[model samples]
Target: MAGNSDPLTPRAKIAVTAGKAVAAASRAAGRGSGSVIGGRVALKLDPDLLARLAQNLDVVLVSATNGKTTTTRLIAEALRAAGPVVSNALGANMPAGITSALAGSSDARYGVIEVDEKYLAGVARDTAPKCIALLNLSRDQLDRAAETRMLAEAWREGLAGSKAVIIANADDPLVVWAASSSPNVVWVAAGQMWKDDAWSCPSCGGVMQRPGDDWFCGECGFRRPTPSWALSGDHVLDPHGSAWPIHLQLPGRANKANAASSAAVAAVFGVPPQVALERMYQVQAVAGRYDVVQFQQRDLRLLLAKNPAGWLETFSLIDPPPTPVILSVNARGADGTDTSWLWDVDYTRLTGHPICVIGDRKLDLAVRLEVANQHFQVCENLDQAVQLCPPGRIEVIANYTAFQDLRRRVGN
Candidate 1:
């Protein structure tokens, strides 16, 4: 609990107490995630809870179709150079989660939060954040989030005339369109690995041409914005060609891009680029991502792939002639009921890689892999999958719920 001299008023205090009590009871009952329910109750009691908690804080909001959690963690790690940083690192990125995080850490003056794609605008308005990290947009949770272009337009409308300094991905055309409305913008070429969502111009509904790293729409004048920061090979290069060597504990070019995005936001906050990059090296995992755990006498490195775009980036992270890979998919409420997005992915990329399928949607994955002509075995369960995998370090790629289940099973 915060100190007695906390800034919250009497009504806010009552709301916070009720929220904490509900959280405690929920945890004791093992019913559901206490973070969401508790926050919902608190907001119902004190509607202005978030706005009050965000007072005098340097709030940084991170939102994307993917990588938001990891990028938010990276930025939070870098921002620690300033002071104690409060963040929701548990992958609960809605109003309830954000409120719970803020109400829990009232003393902290800096907050690095990962906001869900649909809720970014509302949260940004409530917090009036100092900086906003706009990463690439893609097709994720099509049933829940609708189309990626719709989100881009909503973001564009939401961020109009906002004083927050926007750090945006220049490589993603959708991101560029979204952040264009912000008056203060810093564009970074973080490299868009998935361009399927941006093949057509969001501005004029015209076909986009990608010549080298630059993209232009011949029908509309919309083109890739000139970037202030870029990733050249392994180094994060600035305008002067000075390189900041990023040695991350998290393996992947995608993570390196995430680190660069964080570094860009940190720079805008007056933190040195070198300090930001150095801090990012210390982050090995975010909410069970890229964590190696021992289960049933085998070592498994966990990676979360929720959508086709995410799968594309995840596949690039694997080395040539990959290790034994366990691919699990679940079409639960959290993972989205629709699993048809699997066809959008180029599963042929994993043709040479040994694979195993596990989850409620295992058969669906099996059929998809068979159609792709990728050899894979369907396991009865995760343990069976582990038993069937070749002896040595194995990579386990799972969707949302399956990833959470594996993390709990590994005693994370």
Candidate 2:
């Protein structure tokens, strides 16, 4: 029950040592994936390691169906003013990754963590974070995450038992309902573009109606929460109506929203709004999410598109016609074996572009593209695919595993 700042039990010490050894070996063997196996070993030995490592730390936990990683990165950067912050920048967000992050930086005073949505409750219980940032909820990892409404209900149940302040997206009805029961909440109108999974109210099960920028349920009176922190155009508005212009190198309107959400969290932790916004400008790439790198003697910009919502947001940032884009997809376990979500995305958006589809799921993507009337070709090899694209600055968009593969291949 000791806090993370407290001295670890002798057994926990041994566990940490052993875990680090395993992590080192994994790295030596070219199989290291952040703290994946190492943290698992540590937790297996001390079962209560996360709680122990989280002791005495000002922890901020972030969870969402999308943007958790980038948001976490932005929050972590903002927390730097506090000195020596612990965070799992490696993109491993389950219990193991969190455990590794806390265990390695047991002396740190602050922690910023990205948590998988399905495991948020347990992680929250273990870390007893000072604040929990809830981003928009949508259909994702259908095989593992089940239903979005159920996840929202679970989040509602979990926050009801915690004292952590909830910083949530007010535009997401699901997020609003999830944090409704929490006594202390900071709402931000960070925007939500995908509504396919939120037609019915989570609380009343009644069809929700959207008029203007807000939604209300006629049957049960459920509605979008009034936002105290709002993102309007290129500015973030405070509760008092003071606006801070946000200029981020990260592309897309979603990144601006992510900055607004992170700024809200920073404010809760006593970080000045201006200071938080300034810190966010320092982040150019988050685990290869929006970094441009060289591959096959061509400049390729990497964009990670995992689901329908993700694809929709990422596609919007691509430059208009005459820009060639390479689409890569894989049905690996990390990418969620269900490639059916391919049909859910509005591929018609790529109608005029010359699309090069490649990956384990290239055939599936090709079929989808063909139906969408997109101009396309299938190239199994990424290098060859790059060669096929038009000369300057190629845009590469990929699903989970394919994106990781590209990052590894390009040395990002």
Candidate 3:
């Protein structure tokens, strides 16, 4: 076991080696995904090592239905802006993954991570981070995550008495409602998610109606106040209108919500407000998320379509070229044991273009696209799809496993 030896034991070496190989494969496939072999192997060698390792870090953990990776990257960048920081790098958010990230660090005073909701409770208990961040809950991975309500309850229960400072996004009624259970919570706010339609009073299950962008409960008239640290219409600010500019590198209206959330969390570690904003601008899209590529003189938005919400977001970003667009799905068990989820995603965004669908499961992707009332073509493989895609501009929408396949076909 690696436990009987120094930091770089045989198990640790094997884990690190395996992680490097996995990461290399991911990179060679043209995605920037991180690996968890470091932490996984560490756990295999000695089960109780995470607690011992936790004793040496000022760890910060972030979790949410969406935006966890981008938010984690921003927090890491902000921490790095403040001082040296160690990170898992691939947004690996499990106990083993976090351990792997902290495992190989030579100089580590601080670490930041984005964890998945299902694993959050367990990981937090094991790691005992100094600061914890929670983003708003949203519909995602219904087959695995149950319901958003279930996730909110589980997260709050897991965080019940942790001494860590809780940085929570308060604009969402559900998120705010759950955070209220913890009096020690530090609320974060953003203007974009301020939709009165989505808000419901937790006390009475009555609609919480909005008045001039502020809200009040319709049933009992119990009202939750606006957030103390929210992003203003065009600028970032504290409660007192302290105008600040958060330079977010990603495009779209929703990125603002993520940028604001990251800034609020960075403040917990004493990173300057402006640096959080600046680093957001420095934050580029991670691989397979909203990655754009230029192939054969054509502009391609190579995005990963996972759960329904994630697919909806991609549809919003993809301005389907006047020419046919390439949409691909993978059927490998590792990619997603089942590919039936393609039916749930809204494909209305594929309008106005003849879509080119490609993958091992070409029929499935084509059927989904056709169901949405879009003209479509099926390709046996991405190699053929790329060839058919006009040389000037191509937008490739793909599944998780297909990301590597696409990169291999595209040669990075």
Candidate 4:
């Protein structure tokens, strides 16, 4: 087996050089970071480019419907305590992006990759990672991705006989079902706030009985496995019963849950819980998720909430009433063309806050807010939206593309 030094073959070297040139050209052309396009071109030139690039590195793959990017970033930071690490830091999570990241840093000792939920199986197969972190999964981009159960089954089937250690979330039934097939697994009791998708058992299609934090299928005897690591309020408890305080710059219980999972994955790489938590504390933002930008004398704390589950978490992190809140939604390809998912989120949570809506799908959000009996103004853009709020610190929560658009406008 290849170890720390896996030199690229001649063919791979040519492919990497070509990909780098394309990526540079793309950046020069202002077409955004060329990670995806570069990877696509490299893959077309060499079909086995990703597998080849991942040859001798200790790779870790993080996948979920939510928190995957943040978790991936956390895990990467934690792993850096041991050695040099290469990661798709920009949230480009597909095979091409992963390939581009790996090809760029062939000498890095570790690879921390964030895999798209639907593409986890393929990435796992290619990388043969040392550890795979399976975070919570819920409905997202329904038009482009399969249902959560189907994705779970694919995860189960794809990772059946893998040698890698699976670090999985025990609280999520879908994640539990997916990781159950793996023989070597480390379970983390990362809290699952969205229980709508996990009500039915993925195993027997039976009703899942939830007693406290434990969930089980009464019909088939499928149950939540005992976790080795657990999140207790603001602390993470390891198997040895050691409590490590999770003091992260990132807000929300969801991020604390991500920290717990990240600690478990870091432990797989021989990084202690305390050491991992300390390293993860420095991560203030993940690709502009919680970026606080200065705009029009008001500090705009940008929060990215792509789906219902994500929105629920974002609401918990926002400031209370009187602190204005901006809700933005865009139905672009990256944000999922179907804006119907907006209805799944409870807009009533913003009832007390002074609300303003802006984006391509602002009308959709306005109708939802109106139904929730929340008063909101539909603004043309972020400039107008920020102008509506009283100066100070304000919360700006936006879905995928809308958040990206805002970030671009703010020069993030």
Using TM-score as the measure, the top candidate is 4
Find the candidate with the highest lDDT and give its number: 4
List candidate 1 segments past 4 Å from native.
1-6
In model 2, the runs with Cα more than 4 Å from the true position are 1-5
Q: Write the per-residue lDDT of candidate 1 for residues 1-412, one digit (tens) a residue.
A: 2233556788988888888889889989986568888888898999998987887578999999889999999999998997788998887899988998788886686889899989999999899899999998999887898999999999999999999999999999999999999999999989998998999999999999999989999998899999998877778887666898988999888888988889889987788889999988889888889988888888888999999989998988865665888999999998899999999989998877889999999999999999999989999888888988777788889999999888877887
For model 1, what is the alpha-carbon lDDT of residue 293? 88
What value does the lDDT take at residue 129 in candidate 2? 87
Give the local distance difference test score of model 3: 0.69
Scanning candidate 4 in windows of ten residues, the lowest lDDT window is 1-10
Q: Which is superior by TM-score, 1 or 3? A: 1
Tens-place lDDT digits, model 4, residues 1-412: 3665556778878889899999999999999999999999999888898988887889999999999999999999999999999999999999999899998885688999999988989998888899999998898887887588999999999989888999999999999999988999999999888898999999999999999989999999999999999999999999999999999999989999999999999998899999999999889888988889898899999999999999998888788898999889999899888888888898888878999999999999899888999989999999998998888999999889898899999988
lDDT of 2 by residue, 75-170 (tens): 998889766788988779999878877777756778899999888999999989899999989887777778899999999998885789899999
lDDT for 333 (candidate 4): 94
Q: Give the TM-score of candidate 2.
A: 0.97
RMSD of each: 2.2, 1.6, 4.8, 1.0
lDDT (Cα) of model 1: 0.88
| TM-score of decoy 3 | 0.82
Residue pairs clashing, model 3: 247-281, 298-392, 298-393, 299-393
